[model samples]
Target: MNETIGAAAAGPSDIAAAAGRLTRAAASGVPCAPVRDLIGRDDLAAAYAVQAALTATRLAAGARITGRKIGLTSEAVQRQLGVDQPDFGVLFEDMAYADGAVIPAGRVLQPRAEAEIAFVLGSDLADGPLDARQVRDAVEYGVAALEICGSRIAGWDISFGDTVADNASAGAYVLGTERRTLEEFEPVDVVMSMSIGGQEVSTGTGAACLGDPIEAVVWLARTARDLGEPLRAGQVVLSGALGPMRPVTAGDTVTATLSGLGTVTAGFTEGAAS
Candidate 1:
């Protein structure tokens, strides 16, 4: 929208590597002012073309497609973003960490914690009216997850394009034990609690995510359809964050509980051992 961004809108290459560089920057917790400067460019459409190209780069690198994440999926977040709804981003195998794992802090530019519900897909989902039952039926199980969001754009007010190009600030995440399926339990009505180093931090209900976490899953299904990248079987879709997001630091321990769903834990380390 700005004059500078107006010029970037015409740059084809801008879209090609924006997301990838932003991803790399976020993972390493480094400044990416170069990318941030192009936000709101009139050249954004072509830039997104370039940004979308990175999807092929990841696929070519043997990074398996896992699922997608719906971010800002709440009225509160929408207000924060000055938008009506939320946005979504792609997820790959490289962004995942098993439960009880110690995350290498060196990889993330700036790490933050968010509580989420993950839905493992049962079949392919494409554009169409979303059904709560279909989402419930497709759900294999639920896990308590910690979404490690990061950013590399120094100090900037990210526009929709900026956030999207940064892979929604997705750094890494941890998945906990499974807790049946949506059909077997109330995934959206649960009361959740989170702790850091054995200290209570946030509390909320699954309703915090667009009223129902399943609805969040449904939202992802429809969004992917719009993007021509619908959900596929075996893909795990992570719902939006519940409660407030917490920042991560070296040597910190985090544990999140989803009432009936169980718990997930992650530890942060300065770097890989020598």
Candidate 2:
């Protein structure tokens, strides 16, 4: 019989160092070496561990945890990243903005925007696997949302490990004012359109997001619970992007409108508080 071998696990110091590198890159607004280069590539568990540690570092620095964001739920993004499943990251209070707010371009490195449906939970989701219906029932309402994703990995050269260690490449997010209850909204049938400077760039339906945006939320709830952090009530959940992400540069104004949900806008400026 032949014996099977597994990849070596990363120790505490390795995880801490990798997390520190990511923290430095994010704070400096400069890209750094991929985490896989510092730690080995095959240890996804270690990469997530680094992500947790990185979140802790931010929390210690006065950042408050707002909610979570799901990534790679779209088949296009999954294919782009060469992954078959989804990944998630923590969202911070400082990362949120109201509709039509101008985002500080200087704070983000290599920014891009994606349209998504945002769910605000009415009840706490505890540990265990949840179906899409179960996930949908818990939602208080859904709103139009735009996620600003930024990569700390140089030139966006990222593997799964690199992205996971970089907080799912999340930078900031904005939510529109329109809110509709589950009874009035069909999570799987909603259509979305995104435009930059009044030029249509991408279009997709709610089905593009892991079959339905509700399914993405369910996956996040279960995945977070398994990771020892359950989804809580009042936390905003970005279900995932409906279409391909579009590059965002300084002075760019991006808008996304959903079928039932109203439109949301985000403007980027060259400096802070534009």
Candidate 3:
């Protein structure tokens, strides 16, 4: 897999070294330098290879895959990165937090929060054209979600490959309780308002997510399937951000409300020394 990544530009040793750097950063609660020098910027396959290595280690340690999260869904961001499509990260069971739960500050490095629509899949999306209809039909319900993003790369300075290798800067997530079927609510029609410490900080409509959040899922379904891991039943899909991501600090309370999907909140605690 490493040899195939980036057409062998980043070999097995390179992938291992990159993964080791990120693992240490996460373990020490200290951000590390970018891995682009090792993996090469724009080498997406090499970056994903690094991410896969880390994920494999985690799974070996008993962590389980829960779902996936889409990133770079913003058209502006895509243009800035010279890419037309978004990237994705694997979600682990340990990365999920209950709505209203207080997250430990030390659990993530340089955390940020963004509002998103969480789609809980009711069926497999392993085959077919994976069009908008197939993606929507596979959804069991939609709920408001808070994605707590963090970067292991120091100062959040990253190139495309850097962020991808860092698992799309994924940290954790909170899912709302209210579940509305596709018929009950249209994803592109919902508006989002997110506040921290009772102050509005981010706001956007579902259209901000690749024109529609469902479209993001369609892209993800195809991408994941092509990569050999297809979207399956009961896995939650975070359909990219509905708005800008805001930096989060210890003790900050994040609350996001999505029209039709309801609200979700996450609290940050004063961290313990890591």
Best by TM-score: 3
Please give the RMSD of candidate 2 to the true structure.
Answer: 3.7
TM-score of each: 0.86, 0.94, 0.96
lDDT of 3 by residue, 136-245 (tens): 89999999999999999999988888989999999999999999999999999999999999999999999999999999999889888878899999999999999999
Among all candidates shown, the one with the greatest lDDT: 3
TM-score of 1: 0.86
Model 2 CA lDDT for position 197:
94
State residue 148's C-alpha deviation in candidate 1, in Å.
1.0
**Per-residue lDDT over 213-257 for candidate 2, one digit per residue giving the tens place of the 0 to 100 score:** 888888788778777788998999999999989999998999999
Write model 1 residue lDDT over 149-223, tens digit each, in one string. 766666545665666666666678889986567656687787878888998887788899989988877776765
- Judged by whole-model lDDT over C-alpha atoms, candidate 3 comes out at 0.92
**Pairs of residues clashing in candidate 3:** none
Candidate number with the higher TM-score (2 or 3)? 3
- Between prediction 1 and prediction 3, the one with superior TM-score is 3
